[model samples]
Target chain A: MKNKKMAPIGVFDSGVGGLTVAREISRQLPYENIVYFGDTARVPYGSKSQNTIIRFSEQIIRFLRTKQVKAIVIACNTASALALDAVKDEFDLPIIGVVIPGARAAVEATTNGKVGVVGTEATVQSGMYTKVIQGMNPKIEVIEKACPLFVPLVEEGFKEHIVTREIIEYYLESMRNTDIDAMILGCTHYPLLRSKIREYMGDKIQIVNPAYETAMDLKRLLEEEEMANDETTEHHSEYSFYVSDAAEKFRKFANTVMPFDVPTTNVVNIEEY
Target chain B: MKNKKMAPIGVFDSGVGGLTVAREISRQLPYENIVYFGDTARVPYGSKSQNTIIRFSEQIIRFLRTKQVKAIVIACNTASALALDAVKDEFDLPIIGVVIPGARAAVEATTNGKVGVVGTEATVQSGMYTKVIQGMNPKIEVIEKACPLFVPLVEEGFKEHIVTREIIEYYLESMRNTDIDAMILGCTHYPLLRSKIREYMGDKIQIVNPAYETAMDLKRLLEEEEMANDETTEHHSEYSFYVSDAAEKFRKFANTVMPFDVPTTNVVNIEEY
Candidate 1:
């Protein structure tokens, strides 16, 4: 508990999209310190190949290891889908990914056994969610759709815009006929459009946000492994944000999405790693 | 002429977006051989920093140099805006960028001495068009708007979708009341949405595509420097496409946008350069 309390937990993503996950972790575990890295220089890892994604994830993991993190979270779904297997065994720390927790959540929440997943092209192509959910329960059916435009729409700050609704409808048109009792927001950016997605999918469908479940899973793991910070420290937990490019721009964007003020944002020369 | 005829003209962009420029170049200079490199692995250069952009441009330039190109065209707006000056003097060859040519055309086409420029956030933020336009003709009024979402919208193949129309209208809402007679499609991707943009802006507004002008500029430069392939050869002019990631994906996307069939597409290890 003492060693874990002092060592910060690392979180990383392709860009500011993973802040949603980090935000949840901060809320769920107030005592834990967080060290976050966003690969803002080369973002939207969803479009890149598996080799590139793995290379990038390894670099970020190596950087985080230098920060002395007790645990690491691959906050980007694309990275988790494509890079988890390559890095999970290499590191000594408990490394968690968004796919498994999200898949488990969808499996638990689905009453009709039919669950839907929407993510980037790479995430959908990797079929990580479907694979994990099917592994958890062989009978559960997974319907995965690649929502390529959602990330851009979200980045453009069109979460509640009318065009966003239209795009959502267009992407989810096929799912309308299919009976999906629970839908998993497979991408970190998708959670921002929760209301619009919910509005489009109707009241009966449950939108499962993996970020929430991921935070819960981390909490459970920490407790189980006796890594939970049981000490009541006088100092407030700190959050450090690092990005590969334009720290100020990332800081400004983070302020808009994050509930708390981002005070310590720095630029990291990721290539050196 | 014989020496230049054998040496292919080089063109590069951050991703498939630059295929628009390559398409125009192929149309305007059908006889000239072309070598195009798309940095698909680290695309959307508009979001990256100036230093990183310059580094990428230099690497691509080095790679193109190995191909023995007579001249190089910076097909990407962001790269032209950020890296052109840095690399132009470093290399002995005559290098051209899209910004200057587009600005020149905009200034020439405008009757009201008022021009509008729509591009990526980084391109618009760089103020390259405004600077070049004002440098060419100080009397010409340049109104610059960063249409950040256009690239993603185009990549998502929403060029003719209703939501795309809505998005175009939303982005151009501020420009609707302006007295600008000419608007520069500053980014290569913007030209793909030319018809939709023209429809939204009405017939009175002349859309100035930089890719067209850039190709023309390259043609003129080749002629002026006696680098034109004046010698008629029996062999057909070849086109080679290289991407930092998935060559097949780039080839497929290029087929949809390009008029000619892309015959030789290969993957490049850009970082090694």
Candidate 2:
């Protein structure tokens, strides 16, 4: 399946939240080269209109095309919700989005047939999770709340704190009253706040993380397509990172999340391409 | 005291929150050029470490230096709280941060000498606003709360809504009990939630927006330096915008925030520079 020695799997997100997905892909397929584009400058795409999200995502896909990626992962919840269909139509490569995998996982995990979805304003507004889940089982009840602060709280590194706890409790107040068996961490960054989320929701509710499930799906897809790299190649696989904004900040964040060498990351300007 | 053409005053923030500052600057200094860089990708810098904030501030300052800016306004509360000192030492140009201007304005507005500050976790944690307010007037009592979700809520375009109102009420519960005469919209983005903030605090508590005060200070500085651009100029005056992530999204936000078309806007991977 390994015909090309140089082609990379391209992954892009509005910002660092997509790193959760990228980290998963790298862990599952260590041999495959990865070229990641983090639109650190114009991230948190969840609040913008559908037309704007599509336009922004198209530019990212166009940028990735230049990198000659085998497939593109729309690793953003907002983009996945609003622009996935259009992106699939526009691009020739296999395009995967977080919403479907997340939706499927949530549906599979739900025992009461009641699912809860939380994300940015844009994601909640799209009703992507509801549509996908309904498509599979129309009987399932879906409850959605836009926890808009989760992204910034994660980005700001508020994984643990009394204030964070207070905020999480306040945000999850709506779901507590609902009869939801499973809750989808609809946004990629939501995983970082999982402990806080879990604490607030208690042990009864199941949590679904699309980033993790999507990684597993990607592994299966590669094998089915005969695109998996052979084990014979002894060369150390490389990851080239590009961020639309501060490279140093990305390096710091990469170190904190992935525990990798900072110097090796190469920052590229996405617009110039 | 005026030159025919002087470089526009450069203003930068983590996201559209800086628009409040930019709009004010444009209003006060109609004749000058304005260049703004919003690190939208890694915004909500309030929770990041001092070192990371300083590093990010340095990169933005370096970028603004290329524009030959007469002065630089660190419109971000997180950056101002954590990195303003290092920024002032590193650059010779006139620099202003929202915290001091905001603190000063709050102190001036408070007839009762009670001031409240609300921002992201890092800004509140650093005690930057409290220290600045105390530095101005030690007798003035300051109450600080980290309204972590405020930025994300505003960014998500949740300016007015029932749920948004509910969340604002929940967050402002502490302030409602406290007797604060005036409150500083510490974060640049906080002003966008003005109605919500105003509704919660009521008219009795004066709200001081640092963005507005910062713009006035910037205008005064330009005039004092004799660098103010005159009305008569041979070349067409225009504003250029840059972001670290998606150009399309930035353009849309810029269009919404600015009444007129931005001459040019693009996403550049800031690390390559």
Question: For residue A15, what is the lDDT in candidate 1?
Answer: 95
Using DockQ as the measure, which candidate wins?
Answer: 1
lDDT of 1 by residue, B1-273 (tens): 577667999999999888888889889988888899999888989978898899889999999999999999999999999999999979989899999999999999999999999998898889988999999999998999998889888888788789889988899988978989999998998888889999899999989988888999999999888887764658678899999998888998989878878766899888788
Model 2 chain B: which ten-residue window has the lowest total lDDT? B1-10
Residues A1-273, model 1: lDDT tens digits: 588666888999999989999999989998888999999988989888998899889989999999999999999999999999889988888999999999999999999999999999999999889999999999999999999999988887788789988999899999977999999999999988888888889999989999999999999988888887765569588789999988888999899877789876999878678
TM per candidate comes to: 0.95, 0.64
TM-score of the second chain, each candidate in turn, equals 0.96, 0.94
For candidate 1, give the docking quality class from DockQ.
medium
True lDDT of residue A245, candidate 1: 89
Alpha-carbon shift of residue B129 in model 1 (angstroms): 0.8
> Quick one: best lDDT, which candidate?
1
Candidate 2, residues A1-273, lDDT tens digits: the string is 344434678888887888888888878778877788887655658765676678778878888888878777888999999999998998888889988899999989998899999988789988999999999999999999988767766765656645567567767898888889899999888888888898789889999989878887877777777776665467677788887666777878877676456465555555454
> What does the interface RMSD come to for each candidate?
1.1, 6.5
**Residue B140 local lDDT, model 2:** 96
Q: Which portions of model 2 miss their true places by more than 4 Å?
A: A231-235, A259-263, B1-150, B153-187, B190-273
